[model samples]
Target: MKRREAREKAIQTLFQLENTELSVDEAITYITEEPTNSFYELLVRGTVQNQEAIDNTLTGSLENWSLDRLPKIERTVLRLAVFELLYNEDVPDRVVLNEAIELCKTFGDEKSGRFVNGVLSKLTKK
Candidate 1:
């Protein structure tokens, strides 16, 4: 799978893990078993391990919107995209934003793509 596809799968897996009470190890096992590109295993693992810190950073960056108030799919996309933006220096911010927007378009509500883009744009400025 391409990097974009891998990122999308990672976002979906992360969303699944977030909605469930699964342990990180269990979540990782489940996610990796799915058909995905090899490039994303480490990325997914890192994102899961650092999720709390990522969420905290996102919460701080969001202006009027608390993380809880956002839809779950949107929050999950932001978490994955922000992790890439803040922690993965090798990935360009534009790529992160684009992939996040794509994920929103695929998995989120009609307005979520633009919403994700707006939030990520704000985050990059910070």
Candidate 2:
């Protein structure tokens, strides 16, 4: 799958994992019709593996928002975006930020794009 598709799927996987007790394998199946790719595995597993650090990073970047205060979709979108921004060094920061905002817009509320962009812009500046 393309990186974009994988990223979206990874967000879905994270959402599924967050909402249910399903294992990562099960969550992967929950989101995808195609077989999961390396990027998909990388994002989902890496995010899970590094969740504490990622959440800490987000908490610091957020102006007044706590991690738990974010809507579920927005929260999951942030998780995916932060993982890519921190770990996927080969992808351009602009691409990661744009893809994340696009993902939030696609899967989250109307305000999701701007909210994600604002938070991620702070993270990007670091």
For each predicted model, how many residue pairs clash, with residues at least 3 apart or on different chains? 0, 0
In model 2, residue pairs whose N, Cα or C atoms come closer than 3 Å (at least 3 residues apart or on different chains), thus clashing, are: none
- Which window of ten consecutive residues has the lowest lDDT sum in model 1? 34-43
Cand. 1 Cα-lDDT: 0.83
Tens digits of per-residue lDDT, candidate 2, 14-121, equal 988998999988888878867778888999999999999999999999988899989999889888889888888988989988998889878986799999999999
Question: What's the TM for model 2?
Answer: 0.95
Residue ranges of candidate 2 with Cα displaced over 4 Å: none
Instruction: Indicate the residue-level lDDT of 97 in model 1.
Output: 88
- Cα-based lDDT for every prediction: 0.83, 0.89
| Number of the predicted model whose TM-score against the real structure is largest | 2
Which candidate has the top score in lDDT?
Answer: 2
